[model samples]
Target chain A: QQQVKQSPQSLIVQKGGISIINCAYENTAFDYFPWYQQFPGKGPALLIAIRPDVSEKKEGRFTISFNKSAKQFSLHIMDSQPGDSATYFCAASSIKAAGNKLTFGGGTRVLVKP
Target chain B: DVKVTQSSRYLVKRTGEKVFLECVQDMDHENMFWYRQDPGLGLRLIYFSYDVKMKEKGDIPEGYSVSREKKERFSLILESASTNQTSMYLCASIPGPNTEAFFGQGTRLTVV
Candidate 1:
């Protein structure tokens, strides 16, 4: 079963507008929630991450809003630009003796029109 | 900067051919992963290795095998190429399970 579920497989926003993507998980043991951004030809890069202890974490134009009670999280891009168009993935992980095994959501493709 | 490098950017192979995709990390990371990217499917883990000479199957390990002979190198082997296996393969390495990861540019493999 897919542990993490993401919504809105694709998104489109105008320049200067806000772009949002949502994800939900069934496993509460997950302590780390990270967001990754991928360009057309490049690998996915770390954008922002948050833990269950905090409700929100912001980095530049990218923000990760997490709700521990609801078992849900969302990524918000403030003043979205065309450069922000790319694929975004939300992942959940819990550390283990060997290492942390991450479960990723399907994905969200974002398009910002300038 | 920590980096993960995949051997080939693009490769084309014939059916029934044995295909090897290599990944090397300069970060000396203990955790390495192999994933395949498809439209809408996101990144699906195929295999992972936590240390040298150790490997574990991930969510979609069917028809795929992996090797971690050394700490810095992780290889994914396709016993026999199939058209269905055509997709972009990505490799990632992490210092620890919960920390940030370094990813490779990806290898676009086409099985004809």
Candidate 2:
């Protein structure tokens, strides 16, 4: 079973516009949600993350809006630029003694047109 | 910054050959992971090691094996290479189970 599900396998946004990606998880045990950004031929890097206690968390131009009751979360990138074109992944994890095994969504490829 | 380095950027091997992929991390992390990324499949974990000499199978560990003799190094071994195994392999390390993971560039392997 896919514990996490992401929408819009591909996204196209105009430069300077708002780009949003959404993810939903079925596991209530998950307490941590993280977004990862990946460029071509490069490894994924941590973008932004949020915990269940917070409804929203913002860092610079990146923001994560989370809804615990809905079991949904979204990533918002303000002022989207061509440089922001890449693949994004949403992941969820819970603290476990065996180690925090992450459940990841398929991925969304975003394209920002200049 | 934590750095994870894979031994090869690109590799080509014939079918049935035994292929080895090596990864090293500089952060002295206790946990290391191996994942394979494909066009639409994203990243699928092959195996992970939480400590030296300890390994756990991930989602797709059928033909893969792992070894971690040292804290900073983890190795993924392909028992027998096949064309379907061609994909970009990534290595990652995290301080522990609850922290952010740092990833290596990747190793693009093509089994002919």
Candidate 3:
């Protein structure tokens, strides 16, 4: 069973628009949430991360909105650009449990049209 | 910067043959992981090691084994290669909990 679930297997947006991807987890023990971005032929890289203690965290054009009660978190890309097109994955893990291994969502492919 | 390096970018092996995928990390991380990536399936952990000679099974450990003889090197062994095992394999390393994990370029293995 997938401990974490993500939606919109794929997404398409225009330049200067906003692209959002959402993920939900069933494990309440999870405290650390991170988003990874992967371009074709490359490994996933850390985009941004947040803890349940915070409702939201933003880094430049990327933002992570977390809802502890809802057990969901979403990634929003502002001014979506073609350079931002890639596969995005949301992951959750507990620092004190299970070696802190990340449980990743199915992943969402994002495309930005120029 | 942390760097994780896989032995190969691509490999082709015959069914029933033994295959070894090697990964090395330069950051001297205490945690290392092996994961397989498949379309729509995301990344599935095959095995992880917290320290030398200490390993744990991830969500998917069947048909796979691991060895961490040194803190910097983690090896994944396929006792008997199968077509079903063909996929993109990624190696990651993290200093510890709540730390960022760095991934390698990935090795695409194909079992014929």
Candidate 4:
């Protein structure tokens, strides 16, 4: 069974708009949440990550909104641009011993139109 | 920069053929992982290792095996290739929990 679930297999956004992708997890042991971005033919790279201790994290135009009580997290891309078009994946893991085995969501393909 | 190199970017094999996908990391990370990527299905872990010669099975370990003889190298093996096994395979390494995992370019394996 998939421990982490993501919605909206794909999305389209106009330039300068905002794109949001949401994910949820069932494992209460999970405390680390991260988002990864991947371009065509390239490996997925780390975009941003958040710990349960924080409610939100922002890096430039990318922000991660996390709700620890709800066991949910979302990635919001502000001022979406064509260059921001890519596949986004949300993963959850624990930092305890034998942890860090990332349970990834289904993934969302975002297309930014100019 | 941390580099994880997969032996091949693309590979083709006949059904029933035994195949090996090799991966090497330069960072000497203690943890290594093998994941299978499929559209809509997302990335599924096949196997992982925390130390050399120590391995743990992931969600989809059936029909697949792994080897980690050295600190920097992790190998995925297909005991008998099948058409259902054709997919993109990715290798990743991380220093430890809560750390970034560096991934390889990935290997597209096609079994006919």
True contacts kept of each: 0.72, 0.52, 0.63, 0.65
Q: How would you encode candidate 1's per-residue C-alpha lDDT over B26-65 as one tens digit per residue? A: 9889999999999888899999998898888898999899
Flag regions of model 2 displaced more than 4 Å. Answer: none
**Candidate 4 positional error at A65, Å:** 0.4
lDDT agreement with native, every candidate:
0.92, 0.90, 0.94, 0.94
lDDT of 3 at A58: 95
User: In order, what DockQ does each candidate have?
Assistant: 0.80, 0.67, 0.81, 0.78
Q: List the residue pairs that clash in candidate 4.
A: none
* Higher-scoring candidate on lDDT, 1 or 4: 4
Considering DockQ, which of the candidate structures 1 and 2 is the better prediction for this target? 1
lDDT: worst 10-residue window of model 4 chain B: B93-102
- What is the total number of backbone clashes in candidate 3? 0
What's the lDDT for candidate 2?
0.90
Output the better candidate (2/4) by TM-score: 4
Write model 4 residue lDDT over A1-114, tens digit each, in one string. 999999789999999999999999999999889899999888899999999999999999999999989999999999999999999999988887373688899999999999
TM-score of chain A of each: 0.96, 0.97, 0.98, 0.97
Weakest ten-residue segment in model 3 chain A by summed lDDT: A91-100
Best by lDDT: 3
Give the Cα-based TM-score of candidate 1 against the true structure: 0.98
The candidate 4 chain A region of ten consecutive residues with least summed lDDT is A94-103
Tens digits of per-residue lDDT for model 2, A36-67: 99999899999988999999999988999999
